[model samples]
Target chain A: MKYRNPHIPEGINVTKRHPLKELLILLGGALLLIVALSWVFAEFGGGLARLIPFEYEQALVPDALLSSDADSELDVYLTQLSERLQKHMAIPEEIAIKVHFSGDDVFNAFATLGGNVLLYRGLVEQLPHENALSMLLAHEIAHVVHRDPIVGVGRGVGIQIVLSTMLGNPDLNVLGNAGLYTQLYFNRDMERAADAAALGAVHGLYGHVGGAKALFEVIKAERDRMGDGELPAMFSSHPLDQQRLDAIEEMARDNAWAGSGAITPLPAAFADWLKTAALRTESGRNTGNTH
Target chain B: MIELGIFLALLTLGYGFGQYAERRHYRSIIEREKRLNALPAIAARFPPTEPQHHQALVIGSTVISVDYFKRFLAALRNLFGGRVTAYESLLDRARRESSLRMKQQAETLGAEMVFNVKYETASISKGRGNTIGSIEVLAYGTALIRPQAADTDR
Candidate 1:
C-alpha cells in the first residue's frame, strides 16, 4: 500500500500569512483606486455638477437691495430682530437679519443671500408667538450661516445663473408656482444643513427649538382653511410632512432647550400691528384688482 | 406732422417684432406638440397608477410633455393688469415647454390621458443679482395604458 499522508500540513499555514500585512495591502490598493478616480473625476467633471441648463448671454442686472416698501414701524421691528440675532449668533455682523416684505396672500418667509429675511406679511400674521417668529427668523438666518444658497447655486453651476436670469429671482412669485422642482434644485444636502443650523440657532437663542414644528403645524392648518390655489410658499421651498416633521422633532428632542417657554401666538400688540397692516394691503389689493 | 409719422413708424416696427416673436413661439409650440404626440413610440410603457393592473400613461421630463398651464392664464391676466408682462412670456414658455415634455412622456408610456394633473412653476434664480443663473421646467405624471381590469382579464 502506498504511504497515505495525513491530510494535514506539517507547519501551520497561518503563521507565515500576517493579517496585518494583508490588511495594509488591501487598504493601499483601495487608496490608490480612490486617488486615481478622484484625479480622473477632477479633470473631467468640470461643469458636470450643473445638472440644469440655462442661458447666460441674456443676463440682466441682479438687484443687491431688496425692495423696501413697508411701513416704518415694521422696519423698526425688523431692526430689533436683527440686533437680537446679531447678539445671539457668533456669525459676522455684516449678515444682518433684516426683513423684506412680500405682499401676497400666502404665509411664508425665507432667507435670501447673506442674512436678509424675506417675510411675507400673510405668514408673519399667522405666527402665534414671538418665539415662533424668532424661530422662523433664526431658521432662515441659519440657512445663511451654512451657506446653503451658495452651495445650491454652485451645484447648479452651468444652469443656475441662466435660470436666475430667466426666473429673475426665486422669490414668492416663482416659488409659489413650482414646488417640487424648486426643492430638488435647492438640493437635499443644503436643506439638511439649513435644518441643522436652524434647529441649533433656535435652541441657542430661545432655549427651546420646538417652535419650528409648531410653525409648520400652524402653516398647514392655515393652508387647509384657505383651501386651494394658494399653497404655503414654504411647502414649495421646504416641502414638509410627517418625515420632515419627525426629523425636526428628533433634533429638538436631542438638543432640548433648557428653558424655552411655551411659544404662544404673537403678543397682542404685534398681532394688532400685523392685522392692521394686512388689512391695509388687502384693501389696497381689492381696490387695485377692481380697477 | 413729423411726430405723427415717427409714432406710426415706431408702432409699425414694434408690431412687426411682436408678430415675429409670437409666430416663432407658436411654431415652436406646434413642433413640440408633434414630438409629444409621437412620444409613445420611443418610451418605456408605464402604468398610469400604481399596481400592475391599472392602465396609465407615463410622462417623462421633456419640453413637450409637462409644464404649467398658468402661463396662458397669466398672460391673459397681463392683457388687463399690472406690469406683469415681464413674467408673462417666461411663464408661458416654461409652461408650454414643460407640458410638451410631460405629454411626450405620457404618450411614450402609451397613456391615453393624465388626470389630476397639477401644474408647478418654480423660479430657480439667485435673486436679482448673482453670477450664476438657472431655470428649468419639470413636469411628471402617472402613466397609464388604460382599462387595466379589462386588459388584465383578457
Candidate 2:
C-alpha cells in the first residue's frame, strides 16, 4: 500500500481575482448607494422638519450670542434696517428676526435656528452702500423665512443615522463622507432660493437691483483676496459668486426691474461704529464672553 | 480631514507591504514544499504492519495576522454579503504552511510517513469586534519512523 500526499495545485483554494480591481468596484458601488440614499433622506428630512414650529426652533440655538452684538450702535442700525426690509418683504410677524452683528473679522453671515442672524464686521465693513448691505441682510433673512436652518439640521441628522446604521465600522469616518457631497447639493439649492427671495426684497426696498450687485462684488473681492473662489459651484454651499451675479442680471431682465437706481449711503458714522463694535468685542473676549 | 488622510495613508502602506510580504512568503512556501514533498503527511488512520515502523506524535503550528488591506476588503464583503474571497488566500496559506511544517518535523525524525494528519484553527482576536485579527492553524500527525532510524537518533 502506497501512502503519499498528492501535490495539490497552487491557487486551488483561493480565487484569482485581483484585490485592487475588487476594491475599485466595491468603492464605486458604495459611493453610488450613499449618494442616492443621502438625497432621498435630505428631501424626506427637510419635509418633516418644515412641520416643526418656528417658536420651538429657538431651543436649538446654543448659548445664543445675542449679547455679543445687542448693545452696539452697529446692532441697532442693522436691526432697524432689517425691520424696514422685513416690512417690505412681508415676513410673518410671528417670526421675530434677531440680528447679531459680530465684530469678528470673519467674512461671512448666516441665519441660524430661531430667526437669529449673525453678521461679521469683516463683510459689513466692505459694503459700499446701504442698499448693498440690505441685500446681505435680506439674504440671511430669507433663510430664516424658508426655515432652512432647522431643515438643514434634520437633513444632516437623518443622513448621519442612516450612514452609521448601514455602514458601521471604525473606517466609517472616511466612508461616511459620501453623505457630505449630497449635502452640498441641498445647501446650494437652499442658497439659490434665498438669493432669489433676497433679490426681490432688495428691488422692493430700493426700487432697483443696482447696489445689490456691489454686495456680491465685495464678496468676490474678499474671496479673491483670500485666494479662494476657484471652487466649482457644485462643491460650494452657495452658488459661485460669478454664477450668482449672472443670475441676478437674468432675473432683472425677466422682471423688467431697473438695473440702476439711487444707491442709499450707510450712516456717516458707519466706520466709527464698526471700530466701537470691535472694541466691544475685545473687551467681551477679555471678560471670557464667548460669542 | 486629518482622519481621512491617516486612513488613506494606512491603506496604502498596508497594500504595499502586505503584497510584498505575501509574494515573498509564497516564494519561500513553494520552495520548501518542493523540498518537503518527499516526506508525505497523510490523513489516514492506519499504517502498514509490514513496514514494522515505530510511531510518534508530531505537531506544527502557525499564527498569521490579517493585514489591514485584506481586512478592509473582507469588511466590505460583509456589506455586499458575497464571497469573502479576500480571506480565502489567508486561510489557505495558514493551512498549507502548517502542513508543510508538520512534514518538515517528520523528516527531521527520519520518519517514513506521517499518518492520521489533523488540523485545528483558532482566531486569537475573537470578541474584538471584527477588526483585523490573527488566526492560528495547528497541524498534528503520527510519524512512522523505522526502529533502526529511531535508535540512531537516540
Tell me the TM-score of chain B in each candidate.
Answer: 0.48, 0.96
lDDT of 1 by residue, A200-275 (tens): 6667666677566766677777767877534343444454545456777777777665434666455457755666
Give the DockQ-based CAPRI class for model 2: medium
Local accuracy by lDDT, each model: 0.51, 0.85
Candidate 2 interface RMSD, angstroms, 1 decimal: 1.4
Superposed by TM-score, candidate 2 places the C-alpha of residue A52 at a distance from the truth, in angstroms, of 0.6
What is candidate 2's lDDT per residue for A90-175, written digit by digit as tens? 58767878888888888889899999988888888999999999999999999999989999998998788768876887644577
lDDT tens string, model 2, B45-136?
98888858999899999999988888888777777888888888888889989988888889989998899999999999889876648999
lDDT per residue, candidate 1, B1-154, as tens digits?
A: 3443554465455445644664587588766666555333222233333334344544334222111222322322332343333334444556566666676656655565544444664445447333222356565555445565346546
Which sections of candidate 2 miss by over 4 Å? A62-65, A70-72, A232-234, B1-13, B49-52
* Winner by DockQ: 2
